[model samples]
Target: MKLNVKKFENQLLQRLRDLKISNKKVLLAVSTGVDSMVLLSGMLKLSKVLDVEINVAYIDHQLREQSKEETKFIKEFCFARNIPLYVYRWEKEEHPVQSIEAAAREVRYNFFEKVLKENNIEYLVTAHHGDDQAETFLMKLIRGGNIQQLQAIQSVRIFREDYQIVRPMLIFNKKEIYDYAKQLGIKYYEDETNKSDDYQRNRLRHHIIPVLKAENPEFLKHVLEYTQQLTNNLQAIQEVADVKLNKISKEETLDYNKFVKESPLWQRILLERYLEVKGLEIKETQVQQILAMLNDEKKPQAKFDLNEKFEFYHEYLKIGIRIKSTTSLNLEENFELKLNQWHNLEEGKKIGLFKINEIELMPGDETLVVEDNENWVIRHRQPGDSLKMSFGNQKIKKVFIDKKIPSEQRNKSWLITKNKNEVYWILETKKTDLSLAPQNAKIHYILVFRKK
Candidate 1:
């Protein structure tokens, strides 16, 4: 297929302008492969025109014999053009036994992020073209997922706070990229694994895509259009869902009273949004199960486990999510307490300790005046741990029994401590008498605990 070079360049320029990437140093994630090399060539050509600085990042996975040669080629290419290039090698020892693809992706992105942060670059560009987008949509559709999953291979997305990932090649297809590379006499490596049908994506790319393309020459174009439309519609729906979810959500709980009154569609959306906010991935079957449990009047107090890590419960007028507890506690594990930073004690629980120069005490706030910052740590309850009382130290075990705390709850309780066998606070349950005292000292240190 002959690619329209002028049209491709115009689209690429417009995409960058649309992303507002002018006068910025953008990092190109290149693998010395056809698509990425084409992107590198195009970006280098436009760098002067757009007033942009181009930097290249390459990851040598070291899985194939050509890996070293590819790395060398990328270095020589950048050197000849006097462009900056960053390269990272995936050492053989670091590779996992299974799920290597997911692991490689994670490693690749981590390297990209590190390079971006260290160099103070705000834009990371990649070469994900229209054909890849279509393939992703088909894979997700075949595997079965929510609408969000079907809106695949976004052209632009936030990589992190204040940093964006831009894909300028999404308007082009693989054939166009290959054609462009050939026209420019670009030298690139072919990953042998891509031709293998062992992977699902490879199977689809090898068999399904070509058949569809032959059946309808515009298959890629139509699929891209459908993806964009789905994304647009989902964005509109998400806006409404976000507003309603904000009104009804408090931390991890949704006001059951307000939630039930929403239309059934809105109710499902709200539930889905809640799960999304909690970073939990649920299947359609699981969503239906949860909806059924929530709508059951007889089971006002019921719990549903989405997976091993998380579960949600309904109690009268509120729905709450919590981390599922393990069969046994590992009390020996301890986390360090750092001032002015939030320490995650466990899933859904964190504590922040801060030191302030001037102190205005909120009546019920937890404050402690410390002479020195040392030895503070957070850990699960240990056997024979005690809290000092006016007369003597009392065993935490006795306190739990006296307070009628469930055995499971007692096992999961986290405590703040500075010394062995002494508990300062039993986090959200018991506070040391010291923590309750007013901030009358010269300096005030406040400790705040949050459960989400």
Candidate 2:
């Protein structure tokens, strides 16, 4: 079913008007596809009436030399229309980070974010139609995530700390986009991969979803309606879950005894809610751990090594987190050991000379000790930084992996350094680690966490 240009144009204009996106500079992440090209031209047609200035960009993924053709296509189209085009180039070696598609997408968005800082760009416009939304929902569903993961992408998202993202064509179906592009004589380059199951999203679009559509032609409409309704209730769900979970968590700590006693729905909700606060994803396995800990006879403990950043600790009736550094200490950056330090350390920092002094505290009490440790300093991670634990020598990196720390929090963790070896107090990062006696004296120095 082909759509007339005026109809699609009207819909686009209505979206822009509803969003109230400022009529300043809008950056289009153009891929030279039919969807994006059509969106670009529609924005162009609406610009005069809406008072919006537009900039079009084609991100050359450089996955293949053929991708360069997309750059050429978008460049030519923009040149013919007197629209400025920004092209970002990426070589294979430039992104030795992830798979080509993932790497390319990251680099491209990074390009846009960089451009945002330089130019007065107000919003980023994209051409993800109704079909794309359905595809995304299906993907999240298959992955077995809860409501937060399955929430539909917003048509107008506030992405930046200050700026925004606008998707004006979100309500339009792909058929409408295709027809409008054709009727407008818009030229676009179709990457053959889009039609193949080369990517998971494409696989769903090409293989899985078509069968479902054959069964229910109105699947997208129904799903969209359901999502609209869900959005209305999402915040309420979050609020109830937040309040109930906070109640059971008991001072931001999960008491498994109480957690297990709640209804299954509340338990799951609490688990999901707490994990979000702790910066951990509540995967099915992790959820199982929560259940097991709740049912245990004594205080239970479980740790997840989430990307070498932070450790998820759910034991002894509470959930605490620990972040371990992956490399040897970097002295340039200020690294402070929270539980290991001296009396009124002035600044909350680690690694400074202190005259040997005697301090006394119980095994479970907080003690601030100051001593002259020649090799100790607060620093960033370095290569070959090892900790000699009771389990023999192990790389802090390996410890991080075995511990299931989240990746984003790793570098933020401070280290206690002594000579070349790291003084890994409290199992790299633990709620509590044993502090050594001051200057080889008999007095045991223990800094307990402040009791709430």
Candidate 3:
């Protein structure tokens, strides 16, 4: 069934009017692409009938030569209607060639945003139709998404917030939309990409969906309707969850017993809310895993490392988050590394109460190394240090080369220091060491970066 203009216009006008955006200037995204061209035509019709004007903007991604011609046609079409046209030619230079499609889309949208900002355009309208919505739903399902991500495209998106993205034809199917465009004698540019089966969307449209629809003719329509209903239910569930969440939830932690008592649906909602607040989230399986620990004897360790920065722990039926574990020499600022003050290291717990005796070139078992006499900080080798090699007291750096340890690793290495100087040198001066020193009389220190 064809979509009546009055009905379509009424639906759009109602939404825009409710939001007080009916007569505002809209920057129509016209790629001479089918959907966009339909939108441009619809808006042009609307301008005459509804007393408004729309500025047409075409973005040439410049990936193909056809885009130049497509953009030119769109400009000409707009000119015929006396509609103001803006053409932005984007190149690999403007939008780097990496992930061409994604780059192109980003640049195109950014171009629209820029135009909207500069020209004081109120709304950025696009020609995303029902097929687009269906394809998006399919794409999201194929890739992955939670309930929210499944509804990939919103009917009305907020571009600037003040300038809304109003999709007038979201409810119309592709066949009807194309028929509408043809019936109105609106000329549109066709891109070969749309028909190519190489792209996932086209493959789904050309191959997967057709076969599926043959099995169940009304599958797309049913799914679209189901998705719409799902969206409504999702919104309602979210509202109820929000109310319960405010009443029952606590920051950094939750009452495990109380969370367990809630319905499974509510539990899912609370978990989502909790994860979102903590900047952390997990799969349904992980959520179930967390839930399963509620009745377990051993305090099960259920942890979620979010963005690898914050880590959440669910132990003893308690939920809490903390910073990630990093394995790096938490070095001092600039070139002021204090080797003497390294006694407080948790890593060196065994070498408790160790102190620096002397750090110097000495005739030792291994030649040179950094060991804790008490609990001194003997980190990795430094670049500029000169030490006696294990073999014949040669330059310790020569041993490093023989050891095949990278120069970078040697910068913060665990080199043995003795009394801040050799025992003989220290004995001669009787001077207390200022930095990394010999802790033990005889010990071989190898780079045990991590015990594991």
The sequence of per-residue lDDT tens digits that candidate 2 reaches over residues 215-321 is 99887777777776787687687799887776665665666567677887777777777777676775677677656655565544456554457765655445655
TM-score of each: 0.73, 0.66, 0.62
- lDDT score at residue 250, model 1, on the 0-100 scale: 75
What lDDT does each candidate get? 0.83, 0.66, 0.61
Candidate 1: list runs displaced more than 4 Å: 327-452
Clashes of each: 0, 20, 33
lDDT of 2 at 124: 82
Q: 1-452 in candidate 1: lDDT tens per residue? A: 57778888888988888988799988999998899999999888888888999999999999999898888899999999999999998999999999999999999999999999999999999999988988898899999978899888887888966789998888888988998888889899999999999999999999999999999989988888888888899889889999998898877688888988988898899889888877788899999998889888776567889898888887667887888766666779787777777787667667767776543434455545554455677888887799766666778988876675655567789888875456777876776665433556665566667665
List candidate 3 segments past 4 Å from native. 1-21, 48-53, 79-87, 94-98, 119-122, 158-163, 211-220, 248-261, 277-282, 290-297, 300-302, 315-452
Error of 1 at 405 (Å): 13
Q: Write the per-residue lDDT of candidate 3 for residues 1-452, one digit (tens) a residue.
A: 66575776566556445545456777888777668877666666567545566887777777776876787787677777788888888865766646778988887888888888889887887877777777888898988747777866776666745567877667666776677777777777677778888789998888777687779867666767777788788779778877876666566577566776788777777777777656565776766765565445464445655455876565534555678667666533122124332233234321112122343222321221335433233443444444533322334465545554433344444443343322211111111223233555465332112211
The TM-score-based order of candidates, best leading, equals: 1, 2, 3
